[model samples]
Target: MPDSAALVKQLMFTFDDLVELDPMSLGVLIRSCDTDMLVYALKGSKAPIRDMFIGQMSERAGAILRDSIETMGPVLARDVEQAKNNILQKAKNLAEAGAIVIQRGDNANSQVIY
Candidate 1:
């Protein structure tokens, strides 16, 4: 794993960050995220955010995700927290590597930056 503190500082996107994104961009980012983190995020999400990810994935993949969510059993709180952190870490790596771009704010003048 990379330096978590460095990662956090470098790319401080949170669930709030995801919420700030337009649906298309959010979907694309979710598509690139790790499976475990994706699942965890979806499970914790409400309808609108959940729909964003589902809309991005292929039908078959979306179906699989729905099934996984339905069938998932008990999970530890720590594990869930870790999974969210892992997703954030991945996002940080992607941003730092310039593999993805994130819009920093709601301003129309704000350009997308990696």
Candidate 2:
């Protein structure tokens, strides 16, 4: 059997993991995603994760997004998964293109230099 660390490394990066992103990196991700999709994606997300994204935006934009999420009503699980996947893919692409860094584990404490 694989070791615990190896198994952990094999796990997929998830939507909740996005909370680890620095402000600038998170901003890049927010801009990359569609507003409507974001509303759906955040529908049932934890308050902290939702706040992280919303906190990065202007007060008006954040309020609008907060209201949208609050009023988005029920969302299909698959749709939420799809939106999360799309956002994750965008973050991966950004990391690949060197537009942002996704620090993990031991590297999480490192600073992102522009």
Q: Give each model's whole-structure lDDT.
A: 0.68, 0.82
Worst 10 residues of 1 by lDDT: 9-18
| lDDT of model 1, residue 18 | 57
* Tens-place lDDT digits, model 1, residues 1-114: 579876655456565465666666556577677777777766776778677677778899888887887688877767766766776666656666766666776587765543
Clash counts for all predictions: 0, 0
TM-score of structure candidate 2: 0.83
* Tens-place lDDT digits, model 2, residues 2-42: 68764554355778888888899999989988998888788
Which lDDT value does model 2 have at 89? 77
Taking all chains together, each candidate's TM-score versus the true structure is 0.69, 0.83
